[model samples]
Target: MATANTAPNPAQDTLALVGRILIAYLFIPAGIGKLMGFGGTVGYITSAGLPMPEVAAAIAIIVELGLGIALLLGFKTRWTAIVMAIFTVATALFFHKYWSAPEAMKMMQQINFNKNIAIAGGLLALAAFGPGRFSIDKR
Candidate 1:
């Protein structure tokens, strides 16, 4: 009988590298867009009735861009993933609260809420598994 090969596969490392890039895609451009239209983002945050819209925007930029870059480069992978996961969930709760959204906007809010949940799932995986062999952490 042939046994299944359980040893680590190098291809998975390559896949992990690609996965990191894919995950980073979710944040890097968003951060840039938010920065590019700082006032607009602040306005949106303000509309959400969140306290300290400006401060929230600033923190969002740091988490989205700074941690995003770290994830892309696989630097401090586990920690970065943890932080990103938490940020994603918080974003969903604060901004994508579909139940509180107006009837006209409910569908969009639901989509964004679900999307953030999915992204958080991926981040959790990255945290548990680390960034694989291609990462700076070299796990």
Candidate 2:
């Protein structure tokens, strides 16, 4: 019987690299925008009625920017993905609450909510798989 080879494959590594880049790319810009507009971020969070809007904004910046950069570098891939997954899901529940949105905006909110959830699912998958050979985790 032939055994399945488990050695790392270049194609898989490239794909993983691409995945990391795509996901983290979304975060980096978002973080930068939030950081650049700190007051606006805090205001938005406050409007969501979350406690400690300032603190929440800071955490968002850290998670999106710091964790994002870590993911891009493939550093602590599993932990990073797990954290990002949690963050993404929480964002959907808190910020993308379609049920609470004005009727005119409900559809957009629903779409954003779904998108966040899907991104979280992807993050969870990344957590389970670990970063590929190309990551700083180095497989």
Candidate 3:
């Protein structure tokens, strides 16, 4: 019978660190952008045809910024990651779908939307597996 004496794999530890960093880094700029209202984020939300655009903008900013901070600090990582994953999906569908974009911009919009979906998938994985021992949860 195999005993539980397996040595820790440094490669996996490194990969986990990379994954944590990648996922965490992606949210930082987005959160900052929403918090600072950079690139006319509020106006863009209004242009996206959502009802009560300002309210939507505020909610988005709060969720993105708040959850992002939680994720960065590794606090409540599972819940934060799940919330971020859902937010990413919704944002991709509502904001990046680009149904009305011109031909030249359609490709870029599609790529951007798909990229968000991929990011959401990564967040979901993190939510399921957690941030490992290096995180606040430490599960």
Candidate 4:
């Protein structure tokens, strides 16, 4: 029988740390931006045909800011990553919806849709592999 290699790789740890930071960079400012314009965000969500736009906006902020911060700090990283992965998919479906976009906007929306999927893939990887040795979760 073959055994799995359970050893830690220093290079992999460094890469994971960098990946976590890069992913946080993608979301933290977005969350902060939403908070800075709460009403505007709620309006945008309302336009998406979502129910309870205000409450949905608040939950989005919490997931983006709270989970983004958690990922940055490497706190409860696996769970945070999983949450982020789901959030990314929901946002892609609700906000992007490239298939329904008008012709000119279709390309732009499709780009965003793909971007969210890519981000979700990264988040899933983080969920599966964890935050690595440099993280608070490791301490």
Candidate 1: residue pairs that collide: none
- In terms of lDDT, model 1 sits at 0.90
TM value for model 1: 0.91
Expressed as tens digits, the lDDT of each residue in 1-139 for candidate 4 is 1125675688878888999999999889999999999999999999999999999989988988888999998999999999999999999999998899999999999999999999999999999888988899999
- Tens-digit lDDT track for model 1 on 37-89? 99999999999899999999999999999999999999999999999999999
Error of 2 at 62 (Å): 0.4
Off by over 4 Å in 2: 1-5
Cα distance off (Å), candidate 1, residue 139? 8.3
Model 3 weakest 10-residue run by lDDT: 1-10
The alpha-carbon deviation from the true structure for residue 49 of candidate 3, after best TM-score superposition, in angstroms, is 0.5
Candidate 3 lDDT by residue in tens digits, 3-121: 25853355654455567677778777776787686448778887888898777777777777777767766678888888888989999999787677888889899999999999898
Best model number under lDDT: 4
The TM-score obtained by model 4 is 0.95
**lDDT tens per residue, model 2, 21-125:** 999999999999999999999999999899999999999999999999999999999999999999999999998989989999999999999999999988887
Give per-model TM-scores.
Answer: 0.91, 0.94, 0.82, 0.95
RMSD of 3: 3.6
Candidate 3, residue 22: the lDDT equals 79
lDDT of each: 0.90, 0.92, 0.76, 0.92
Query: What order do you get sorting by TM-score, best first?
Result: 4, 2, 1, 3
User: Local error of candidate 3 at 82, Å?
Assistant: 1.2
